[model samples]
Target: MKNKLEIKIILSLCFVTIITAVTAVPLQSAHAFSWPCIDRSDGKAPIAVSDDNVYVAWWGNTTGNYEVMFKASNDGGKTFGDKISLSNSTNGTSVEADVAAFGNNVYITYADNKTGDADAYIRTSNDNGKTFGPEFKLTNNSDSSLTSSSLPQGMKSYDNVKTSPYELKVAAEGDNVYVIATGGDKNDTTYQPDVFIRVSNDSGKTFGKDINLSESKGIVSERTEIGVLGDKVFVTWWDKGSDGTDTPLLRISDDRGQTFGDIIDLSANATDSNTTNTTSS
Candidate 1:
């Protein structure tokens, strides 16, 4: 009886060892993991998908300075390539990166305090995010000429309440690319930021002048979103109204962002109302 008991114990131990060995084998495909960056720092990360390709953009102080970083996955999001810095120059602090992709083209837009005040800039990737070209300045609101260090710190909130950082959004389809951002008008003494759009006809190679979409006198808060479907372009954001309540607004472009129609209030009764739009061809 003692011999039989010993044999049973040995057999159980062997089975356990076999199961552990099989489970220890590494997976052939990489899984999604965290991107390392400096401590005590955070920023927005927006993603765009085109078929099986995935593109992601964010800002971090990994290089001891805040920079817009990008990562791409050709095989969906199962694995990602090495991170690339879109704001790879001495262009002050860059943050709030927004990404958009169509076919082989990828677009990234962010705000940089290179000229003292925050201005929107864009970088385009023609090879499906494997490489990026020089950044093009989209807004000229840095007339204040304040020093870079004295620029707005981190992200600005609306009415000192909502803490989400305002995002510079981008949308792309075929050879057309559109970007929307919230920035102050140099001529306005009230200093309230306005939503502006810039259109690119040559697949982000060149962009037209910045056209103000939200001409509201009230403060523009929260992130601005853009969507492109066929020849119609849609944009939405939140702004403070005369009643001291945040209301959602929308503007549509029927001619590929050449001109935008009057602002349409999405919600006038709701306070702190924010909106996002998604459309398909």
Candidate 2:
């Protein structure tokens, strides 16, 4: 009986060893477990998919400074390639990156503070995010030079609340790219930080003049999103009404952002509950 018990114990020990070996084998990482950034990071994490390809962009501190970084996956986001820095220059930090792709073209826009001002900048990748072209400054104006855009005056409220920060969001279709953002000082209620837009016809290689789309007096306006579908480009954002009441607004461009009409009010009863449109086609 003692010999039989020893044999049973040895068999149990062997079974335990076999289970441990099987479980300890390093398996392949999951699809979402990819794209490792080295430093402190901020990820709006705008991603675009083109059938089998996936492109992602963000602002990360991989090299001790915040720069716009991109990663691409050819196999449906199963695995990603190495990081591609898209700031176009290593001189200053960049943040608030927004990326969009159409066909083989990828466009990235961000607020670059390399010169102590957050100017809207853009870069293009003609090869599905593998490489980027030159940088184009959309707003061209310094932070202080930007004026607070107004909203339509009416039975509005003013809460004396501040405006939002300067951040860039962009969208693209074919060779056309549109960018929207806010800029300048927030403390000054007069000339409050305003929302602005810039359009590109040649795939973000060049941009048109910056247009202020707000219309309210003594109001602060900021935070914007741009979208393009067919020939129409749509923009939306929140604004502090003439009296600090919050208002949600929308506008559409029919001729590929050549001109915008109909600043539609999405919110009927306005308050401080800010609403923002943060995407585009």
lDDT of 2 by residue, 110-210 (tens): 66646533345667778877778777655322222112243124312221111112456778887887776654322233444455666778776556655
- The C-alpha lDDT values of all candidates are 0.59, 0.56
**TM-score list, all predictions:** 0.69, 0.68
Candidate 2 — which residues are off by over 4 angstroms? 1-42, 88-91, 142-165, 184-189, 269-281
Model 1: CA > 4 A from native: 1-42, 114-117, 141-166, 218-222, 268-281
TM-score for candidate 2, residues paired by index: 0.68
Model 1, span 151-245: residue lDDT tens: 33541321111111134678998899887655544344344556666677778766666566666554544357778898899888878766778
Give the lDDT of residue 175 in candidate 2: 84
